[model samples]
Target: MVFDASARRRLAPYRMYPYLLMTVEVPSRGITDQWRRTGLARLLAEEIALAT
Candidate 1:
């Protein structure tokens, strides 16, 4: 899913706090495959600046 400008704006304020909730949906058959192939966790960490 592509995060557009409006989505970024909406999420910007959460940057100042810790722990932002997010939901992701993936097809059952592709869940493991996608998790192993993607850098989603890393990407989210970078986006939210979660040091730990």
Candidate 2:
């Protein structure tokens, strides 16, 4: 899946870290919003809460 500019900006901070294990969450109804990931592939999931 691909994210547009707005989504990329919103998620930019999370993508900066590729080593440590972290979680991020963005509010959206899209099915791709949930996953277990690491590195630059990590994105908004069902756990970590972030204020957009």
Candidate 3:
């Protein structure tokens, strides 16, 4: 999925200063493991909350 400039702008508030680009490609198992190992999902949740 991709976000357009406007969408990215909308998320600006939740984003930390000095935006960084990170790309991750992992197997389903790895994704699940990381989901549990780190609170990555919360980051998305927080962004969405701020967008609202």
The regions of model 2 sitting more than 4 angstroms off are: 18-52
Which regions in candidate 1 have their CA more than 4 angstroms from the true location? 1-23, 27-30, 34-38, 50-52
TM-score, one value per model: 0.33, 0.31, 0.36
User: For residues 1-52, what per-residue lDDT tens digits would candidate 2 score against the true structure?
Assistant: 9877678667756654442233333223233433434322434331123323
Task: Tell me how far candidate 2 lies from the true structure as C-alpha RMSD in angstroms.
Answer: 12.2
How many residue-pair clashes does candidate 3 contain?
0
Q: Candidate 3, residues 1-52: lDDT per residue as tens digits?
A: 8888788777676483322222133343355565433454466455655555
User: What is candidate 1's CA lDDT for residue 22?
Assistant: 23
- How big is the RMSD of model 1? 8.9
* Better-scoring candidate (lDDT), 2 or 3: 3
Model 1 lDDT tens row, 16-41: 23323222443443466554335555
Query: Cα deviation of 40 in candidate 3 (Å)?
Result: 0.9
Backbone collisions counted per model: 0, 0, 0
- The parts of candidate 3 lying over 4 Å away from their true place are 1-9, 12-24, 28-38
Candidate 2 similarity to native, TM-score: 0.31
lDDT of 2: 0.43
